[model samples]
Target chain A: MSMTKLTLQIDGRSIETESGRTILEVCKENDITILTMCHLKGITDVGACRLCLVEIEGVSKLMSACTTKVADKMIIRTSTEKIKRYQRITTELFAAERNHVCSVCIANGHCELQKLAYDVKMDHIRYPYLFPQCEVDTSHPLYVLDHNRCIVCTRCVRVCAEVEGAYNWDVMNRGTNVRIISDFNTPWGESITCSDCGKCVEACPTGALWPKAVVQGQLNKAPEFISDLIEKRKMKL
Target chain B: MRVRKAKKEAEISKNDPRVKFLANKIKKENYSPGSLIEILHTAQNAFGYLPLNVLQYITKALKLPPARVFSTVTFYHFFSLKSKGEHTCLVCTGTACYVKGAQAIVNELEKQFGLHSGQVTPDNKLGVAVARCIGACGIAPAVVLDDEVLAKVEPQELTQKIKSKLAAS
Candidate 1:
């Protein structure tokens, strides 16, 4: 099958690309920055997090760059004032939704969510703190599931099902009440399907899922590792 | 306690006629994964609420991951994982109803019965809940008792009315 050629302008620069690639991919190739949370390169994109929204010239609403395909002759603006404002608000909400005390978190400086807040210049949250009674599940023996720090990006859910093929982590409930559950809301140590792989721990953007071996400020995760593995697996050799 | 709970759940799945109805519905739908919502509706209707065993049975019958079945069930408000009680009082808290003193009625219920919305009495006789809207704005301040919609309800009379309903059955 031959790849279809297309022309598009991003950030006022004329670029030529092939079809079947997302706007985010085109932006990355050109060194344009697009913020995202629920996107994992190896697996599918659900566009759950709205951080990658970009303003297309003809479109009325902002489109998520990770999921929106690059069309012919499209004009896209990735860093408009409106997009920045929305991104800041989104970052603020993530902070206020649960208890994310960065100073005490396991991932601290290494956390993607904390880094996102710094990038967006989110100093103080305007939204009310939900202070929901979230759970900290230490039943896995090897890992911990802390609901307080989760943003519900479902990165762990996707990576577990797609990369690890364990299908152990899934979200339950909706809105502010939602939570990641293991096999019928059972304790992680009691899961019948989990292979005890730590792929989910690495895929987690926040300190929501972490290995029990690591303490506060000692955590390191490489989501890019999953993407790299996928690329190598696709080789014919 | 965990073992006991599991055993009781197994007993229900083994003996309940409702489980048979749910199984029949699943079979009729050919156990297609696309029919998940429909099967869940049948299961909810037959069982009055979705239990763990019923969800597990559906998951097995459809050959789907337990997580998938659970996520679908929790996404929709129409399905309840817990019982809505023997009798339910659903107050409409939509704009029109709120303007017509729906909050007052809710407050009255909380004060009188010491049970907030989404909560059932200790005896499990009556459950209190609130709806975004019941679409009965023509009769704002509507409350649904069981399946009957009571319109233009007063806050002071709600407790008495609920008590009477509970006493009936």
Candidate 2:
């Protein structure tokens, strides 16, 4: 099938792209910097983090680039001052939501949330810390699930269900009370459906999910590995 | 012995009217996963709240993951995992109601019953809850007890009604 070409204005630059692709895909293709979380290449884009919000002309509400598909003759501004302000606020909230102590974390240097904070130039969180007592599940023989560092991105949930076909991880509850559960909120080690594939650990953006073998600042997660594996699987060789 | 015990428990569950009602409702819904919320509503109405076993039963019947059912149950505020007690007092704390001293009513209930909002009495007789808004702003301070909405209520009057409700056989 031939792809239909469409024209759009992004950050005052006229670009021509195909139909059915999302604004995020177009931005990435054009080398336009658009921030994103809760979006991994291999699985699906839920647009939960709301970091990739772009100001579309004639639209009052800012649309998330990851989920909103590009249309014909659409105008989009990625980094307006207002957008930057909102992005900084979102980064600050992610910091203040839970106890994300980078120094003590396994993925200290490699954490995506930490990088996002630096990218947004978030020096100190403006909001008051929730300080809710979160659980650290070390029940999995090879991995750990720390709720303190989790941003509720649901990447692990998607990866487990989609890639590994385990369907072990799922989100429970709502709002601040929300938590990632394994097999009806049971311990990770006790999860009957988990295939012990560790794809979830690889897809996690923060120190929320890490292997037990890694200590503080030693964890290195390769989320691209998931997308790369997907590409290899599609090869006709 | 364990097999006999299982059979006995199954027989008792089969005889339970609430369980029977839930089974019939699930069957009526053609066991579709989309009817989970509807089934849960019926189950809650029948059993006062969703017990773990009832949720498990629904999960099994719907062929859904336990986590999925659990997540759905916890997402909605209307659904409660624990019983809301025999008598429930839901005070509206919407902007309009708050301005009209709805907080005073909630405080009075806490003081009189020694239980906070979203809490039930030790004996399971009374439960106190707060609503963001029930859309009854005209009657600024509205309270719902046993599904009956009481409008323009004073703290003392609300307490009096609750006391009477609890005292009744």
lDDT (C-alpha) at residue A74 in model 2? 99
DockQ of candidate 1 against the true complex: 0.40
TM-score of 1: 0.89
TM-score of chain A of each: 0.98, 0.98
Each candidate's fnat: 0.61, 0.59
Q: Place model 2 in a CAPRI quality band.
A: acceptable
State in Å the error of residue A224, model 2. 1.4
Number of clashes found in candidate 1: 0
Interface C-alpha root-mean-square deviation of candidate 2: 7.1
Q: DockQ of candidates 1 onward, in order? A: 0.40, 0.36
Q: How do the residues A1-237 of candidate 2 rate in per-residue lDDT, one tens digit apiece?
A: 567999999999999999999999999999999988899986889999999999999999999999999999999999999999999999999999999999888888899999999999998888999999999999888899999999999999998888877788888887898999986687888765677888999999999999998878989999999889888878997
* Model 2: residue A97 alpha-carbon error in angstroms: 1.4
lDDT of 1 at A147: 94
lDDT of 1 at A72: 96
Q: Model 1: per-residue lDDT, tens digit, A2-57?
A: 67999999999999999999999999999999999999897999998999999999
